[model samples]
Target: MNLKLKEKIRESLSAVLPITGIVLMISIFLIPMELGTIVMFLTGAIMLIVGMGFFQLGAEMSMTPIGEGVGVQISKLKKLITVLLTGLIMGIIITISEPDLQILANQVPSVPNMVLIITVALGVGLFLALALVRIRYKISLSVLLIICYAALILTSFFVPKEFLAVAFDSGGVTTGPMTVPFIMAVGVGLASVRSDKNSADDSFGLVALSSIGPILAVLILGCFYKPTQAAYVLEDVETVVTTQDVARIFARGLPLYAREVLIALLPIIVVFFIFQMLTGRYHKWQIRRIMIGFIYTYIGLVLFLCGANVGFAPVGAYLGKQLAELSFNWILLPLGALIGYYIVKAEPAIQVLNHQVETVTNGAISVKMMDHCMSIGVAASVALAMLRVLTGVSIHWFVIPGYFIALVLSRFVPDIFIGIAFDSGGVASGPMTSTFLLPLSIGVCEALGGNLMTDAFGVVALVALTPLIAIQLMGLVYKLKTGKGTPTERAVIADDCDMIVDLEEDE
Candidate 1:
């Protein structure tokens, strides 16, 4: 247990260091921040590392097992109605509990928070059931994606321009830390039942499909809740001049987040308890471990939210505004790109997705490689987002072409890569992007007098979109590399099964 915790902390350190160092460099050389702000940012970075470590370990211990157990049990049931209903219940429960979704719900002022939350949760439930059906029936992921996205695009025309970016952002944020681990594990559990060679590939794309649902649902809601513009109000960051002030800030924020995290976690815990009572799936020891995991997850989430909202968010906004106000405001593009590249590595959900992908592919796709690809993709997305902020370009100019390219590339990449690529899109836009990057973009947009809804709102969507293209491009390269190989030879090239074994033992 101690070893696993240490490993998680080590992973978080590696992920957090690059971005923290970059931020410090930027503060020193480019945009000079207040000493108080710098202190807060550094403190937040420390909390992020510690919080992510615990959270990832907790997820591995709890969410993965519960999701997989539920999935496997549901798959074994004979009735199709039972399977679909189980999925619907699970999806709604999980989506409602998602911390990222709650952040998003609070941001959009036009819709009531509960109304929007319920709408998005229902969408997740419905589509999650459809995803299950797709897996069972061997439905083609690429074809389903094309059809769903085509419909989403067509619907976008009817949605008010003010709501367009928000609609897409909804999709990206819905598949956050709470949702991703559980949904991906559910896919793995469902796929494990199949004997076919493609079953492993099929264990992905649930996240990809689930992401689309909220976009569609929200877009439909937009038709009715049309607003000329979204009203956004940036919160003021209190100055912190001393270590005591910083401690006070975190202390004040912690209890609020503690309450929020408890509220967020309660429903899921209840669901798990009911499921266990009905099925008796877990042994006594496993239950104890999972309960401990829940405690870790609770503490981690509270610390993470307190640190991120109190410390990182204000700094992100301040940086964006300061950079954009420069004599050469265009520098925000490259700087934003650089920050995006490293910031994604620090996202808790991204780490989970990378580890899962490495495990699923038996290290054919190394976690290092996945991290590199996601970073590049997010870097490009931030560059484009910054460009939009600088030039006041319509988001459609980028998003339409981006998704078109992603969908088109879906035809050429391997099946597993398609799943990983789309899943990566959602994973890439977890809490970090929403809390930090979104505020950063909004700060820039406000400084530049750009429409916040159109220009700033789509950063998360773009963050989600780019990975779809980048990972698939990696897939295309991978495909070409093994094109001439026989089946066994291709298997040998595609997986490091022996190496995976050694790595597991080392762990």
Candidate 2:
């Protein structure tokens, strides 16, 4: 209704149309897509567009401000123990609600669903505390990452071969739609309370750190559990006979998601309500507007999930199976690369992150630049994912080297770039990667007689890993040209209010 909301919608549409058009053209050419399937794709696309619009609006209205408020309050508390506890609790709560984690948990055959969820949550909670401590003490993110990864590599050897890929993939999926906006905003909020120049840079590593929790936890799970069975059960689908049937189906599905999104959002809502009661930070008018925005978010998430899970997943699985069954299975590499490029553009959280990165860097890091970096990274990751299925390469071979390069590059990039790079890694792998890409990979792996847990499971992890190097490489280039030092000493520079403005005006 308002100008800002309209602009957000415009941005969402900009992202959706290109992918929709490309997919449509390709479907018409490559496959004998039926009318019903076409309708399903359109329904999913519309849901994605509207979902992005609503989710972004809700994040702006509710998550960002609330996270920033919480960050300020937590900083004022000034006690290291309290700050660490707050971070840990929030991490657990947020990761538990993560939709991406659920997507992953359902696919894993070895661990009990609740056990996997709790393990992942605990992992996130522990690392989130470490992230908070890093912010509090102004630790070098690169050094911490190196040390943490050293532990990851050492742990990998003891873990079973089949579970390793899934374990790494969990790192990427754990920071999904529900987690990204809140955690990133929390970083921004916390960074805002400090005068550190690197505060903006520091804000990004939260998503990066939170991703680490699941990898470690899942790896630990693998040590004790052997994944003997591949969980690739085909979901039941009732073919809709007509347009009205599709409408009825969506309507029936809507309420289920409405309930789920509301439940997912309840913790943050309650936290905000309590914060408002105590601090009275917002006026009545502001609360009314935010509540309305939250309603849109709830509706948006419901449609988005219903459409994606019901409409998109089966299609992805079918396509991957069809393609892999062909003599030309290797063709999945370039085709997947093209899809990965376009699909990353469609990820809801990526738009928010792209805008944030452009802002934080004062247009020094443009959205187009970020998009280009992510596109290339995703393109490469998807290709690798396809390759993994065809060749059955170990995930550690790719991930260890990929992370090693990313960690080493972190030392050379500007502090802001370091933060943004890690954040980009998480944002690049959002809901779409888990829902579509993971299924696609699994289908292909199943068709190819590859180990599902090992071959298909690390697609999300690869998606998350590549961006760290890509974005940091972008930063390295920027620094080489501009000669800016890593913002280590100026991590807490006072009075750089332009950070907020920079994010807001991103083109």
Candidate 3:
């Protein structure tokens, strides 16, 4: 276990170092931030590396086992209502536990936090159950995505303009690092019960369908709830003066996030205990391991969130404001693009999703491919978001067409890629995007005196949007390279007896 954690930390270091380097370079040459602030950022980066290491290991042990156990048991049930209800209840509980959703809820000032959280939770529960039904019935993922997105698009017209960005953003934010692994493990468990050729493909779409719930839920809420756009304010971050000041900041911050992570993780623990009570699924030793995994998860998240919120966020905001105020402010466009290019790699959930994809697809979609594709997709999205900040362009201008293209491409790509693409969209926009990139955009928008709701927001939505198209396009290239229904396709997603096959896009 120690060796495994060391490996995870090493991998995390590789993932995080590039973005950390970029920030250091920018601080030294471009922004020239206060030494104390730079020290805080460095501290946060260290926390991130260690936290991510522990989080990944913990998730694999805890979330994976519990979710898979639940999924397998649920799939074995003879009655449909029991399965659906189980899915619904599980969805609601897990989503309510999501720190990301809680973060997003606080961002919307007009709507009550509990109200928005419940609404979004209900949406996830319903859609997650729907996703299960789709898998059970062997329904085409493309058709369902098209229908749901169309409803979401039509619903947007009745929504107030200010709420649009927030609504779209809710979709991305709800599927952050905390939720993706468990939700996906359930899908894997559910699919493992089946012997059909399509189970692997079906397993990939749960996150995709689960992502749509927040958008639809928030958009519907927008129709009735009128928000006061100008009332939205960016919270001011406190300045650090000395080494003790940075230590004091983290010392104070850790407990707050520790409480938050505890609250977020409690429901899951209760559910697991209930599951054990009813199912007697695990051996005593297995139960002990899971409980330990939970502890690791708890500690990891507290550190990760504290570093991100207390350390990275203020620096991101300050940098954006400073850069946008520059005489050569046009540099914001390129600089944003460049930072975004590397930042997506640092998202902890991206590692989970990449590993999951490779495992489920039997290496058909390599981690290297997923990494490059995600990076490029996110780069483009952030560039476009920076443009929106500079010019105050409508989100629908990018989103509507982007989704349209993604949906259109879905028809042409392999069935597996459609699910992978949409899932990537959600995974790409993880906690990092929320805590750092969102604030950066807000800072730029604040500096330019743009509508914060309209211009500054939706960075997350864009982050979630482009990967849908970018990944499916990679699938298109894969299709051309490996033709339809070829050995690569079949072998990549085969049973245990099949050998692992590699399909490269040549980077």
Residues 416-507, model 2: lDDT tens digits: 88888888888888888877888889889878887777788888989998988877766755664464654642232212223423433463
Task: Give lDDT tens digits, candidate 1, residues 172-244.
Answer: 9988878999999999988888889998899999999999989899999899896666665666567987899
Deviation (Å) of 57 in candidate 1: 0.3
Model 3: per-residue lDDT, tens digit, 188-267? 99889899888888888888999999889999999988888644345555678888888898999999889888999999
lDDT of each: 0.87, 0.80, 0.87
Count of clashing residue pairs in every prediction: 0, 10, 0
Task: Enumerate residue pairs that collide in model 2.
Answer: 195-492, 195-493, 196-491, 196-492, 196-493, 197-491, 197-493, 198-491, 359-502, 359-503
Model 3: CA > 4 A from native = 230-237, 485-506
lDDT of 1 at 504: 34
Model 3: weakest 10-residue lDDT segment is 496-505
lDDT of 1: 0.87
